[model samples]
Target: MSSVEIKVKRLNSKDAQFKQTLLSSLSLPMADDEAIDLAVLKILAEVKAKGDEAVLSFTKQFDRLGVSTVAELEISSKELEQAYQGLSAEQKNALDIAAQRVRSYHERQKIEAGCHSWEYQESDGTRLGQKVTALDRVGIYVPGGKAAYPSSVLMNAIPAKVAGVSEVIMVVPTPDGARNSLVLAAAYLSGVDRVFTIGGAQAVGALAYGTKTIPSVDKIVGPGNAYVAAAKRRVFGTVGIDMIAGPSEILVLCDGASNPDWVAMDLFSQAEHDELAQSILLCPDAQFIEKVQASINRLLPEMPRKKVIEASLANRALLIQVQDMEEACEIANAIAAEHLEICAAEPRKWAELIRHAGAIFIGNYTSEALGDYCAGPNHVLPTARTARFSSPLGVYDFIKRSSMIEVSEAGAQTLGAVASTLAHGEGLQAHARAAEMRLKK
Candidate 1:
């Protein structure tokens, strides 16, 4: 184990410079590159022009897999079934349980938060309301270059399926002609309509613009690397995207009562994700903060990804000393973290004070890791302070709402005068005339 002492910033909420320091530290470095954007734009245009041939070329060049036709990149149903059957019993059981939990949670979200068609008739017989309908098709981009994410497959696909989407096409990169069986099994379990072994900007382009083999989708959802993010941003108007997610983050509000080791490990969780991931602990007890620091120093060496965690901690991690739980909640709201953990004696009490966060884990026992996988809540959450206005991926993200309006002849007579007056005031003669045309003579 490496004996290097990790250097993390320490701050006190009472200090005059605390706010400024916190804000500066929380700011994420811009990951975009002009060269990457230009490359992505070129790839998108090429795919748009040459269709399947261009996609095949990029697949061979980037993923190092030479396939004669784009159709060959598509994974067959038999292969998906075989992948599922081949998993060890424990792995199969875990996947089945996680899928079931996720499906159940999304099914509930559909009932409660899902859109509905409702209309109310006015006294004059006019009816107006909204009609909610799921997108016909969607594409999910699952990352596969560095790690296989079966959980992501379940998270992105199941919600669309629950939202009543007709077709769910998934794209996962298979580097060097290697495919992850667990990811395929997840697609099978989540009821993905199609699976393509393609990724990067080219896959996103194919999904955004239909090729001969792959169909265009109404929206694209999922997470990927920097190039994929740039591609998604480039194709926003052509198709809807989930969000441009930043690095993962976690903010813990502790009352200095929980085990120091547990809190230390919790901080390590997000830090281990990557070098840019952020982890911060807010507690009133300075002694407890020191203990947690020592715990971090002692336990971090045990982590296999210690170098990553060390870099993340050194760059972005913090051990904050707040005045009390109330101050901690105020700070948490300002940060608007992706994951917020209230580890205290009265976690719910402090949780009630939190106004903004992507997801909240209450009490010492509820770790952020649980919510990431089997906690029945979506792991696809808003990041980079976007949670201040946005929310986690849910059934609502997969559906669209259309206004429903039916004007009765008598109703038009009653409403036309108001609309005509407004339209004429706005100098819109066409609008006024259209409203007048609907009125009775």
Candidate 2:
């Protein structure tokens, strides 16, 4: 098969202002697949109306699995045991190692109950305080695609478990009546309460709205395709959801010291994820840029998904030559890449300079892929420049804190006048009267 070719051209320094223009202009040429959207929506509505019957029909229609009832949708312990027993020793060992690292990293995020009180002499006999508590139950969605991501299952499930959430539910897609054994094993090992074989917007909708079979959950967390994102958006008010993720992306800030081959291979790490993935390089040395571009071309053919990488690079990839490292950092902060790789001489110093990014990989050895699989940092990251405001999935995502303010009778009297004055300024007579009544009591 003839592979797609990308021509690399040297950028002229005369167009310095155009550097930002070119960098900002780079984006994936993803034409929306509206047909898929319409089909998914119709299936989702049908599932909501027909419930389990509709789910079964779509399973057979889209997944070619003749699962006609909700009973079949549920994976039994025997099946899970069989899946675990079926894995090779090597695969089992790899999963064990990955889970250990992920669990250890998230264990540190656990929270403890907190309380505070204040007392003051106020001519009133009233007291008040606030309390915070964990949600009763939580849901996690793991995407079942070309390959099952055991890593994702760990990332989503472990945090909720640590957050003291009572129940943790996980849902994954199984195409053609097949589910990845590794994925099943991951859920089993992660202490997941229940694992259902459903996916896409319907799975999200079912979790959000609750069907006769699947119980509704307080929050849903995980990563999925565009349809899943849209479903999560629709269900936001009814239930809480993790951020809507975007395509994979990486920004490498390198100088002349980095190896061009290592850099090229690092770019491929995210490009393999999706055709829309973006890989960018910002360096002061023009010659280094050419070398890395050459390395990319040389390494492209070796990749199994070279066609996807080619298309990704042709559209979203960029080589930005800036005036210096400071300029590079400024540009990087503006983009707020999901994965920021700093390959400068003193990378620790440069890495500290970065203010906005989902995760940062410093030095040549700390490749972005390490964090994706086993570095213990959550791989379910914020994408589409959301790093500027949002954050990676962690224990904080699962827990909610209520302001705990308690006042003794004296404290109420001291605070009453201030509260009443503020409420009166806001033009709410009832609010001012409420505080005055407390004072009188």
Highest lDDT: which candidate?
1
Query: Can you tell me which runs of candidate 1 are displaced by over 4 Å?
Result: 1-4
Worst 10 residues of 1 by lDDT: 1-10
Q: Which parts of model 2 are misplaced by more than 4 Å?
A: 1-5, 8-20, 23-44, 111-132
Per-residue lDDT of 9 in model 2:
34
* Global fold similarity of model 1 (TM-score): 0.97
Tens digit of per-residue lDDT, candidate 2, span 358-438:
999999889998898888979888888889998899877777766545566676676888899999999999999888887
Distance from true position, residue 110, model 2, in Å? 2.7
lDDT for each residue of candidate 1 in 307-423, tens digit (9 for 90 to 100): 899999999999999998999999999999999999999999999999899999999999999988888899998998999999999999999999999988898897898999999
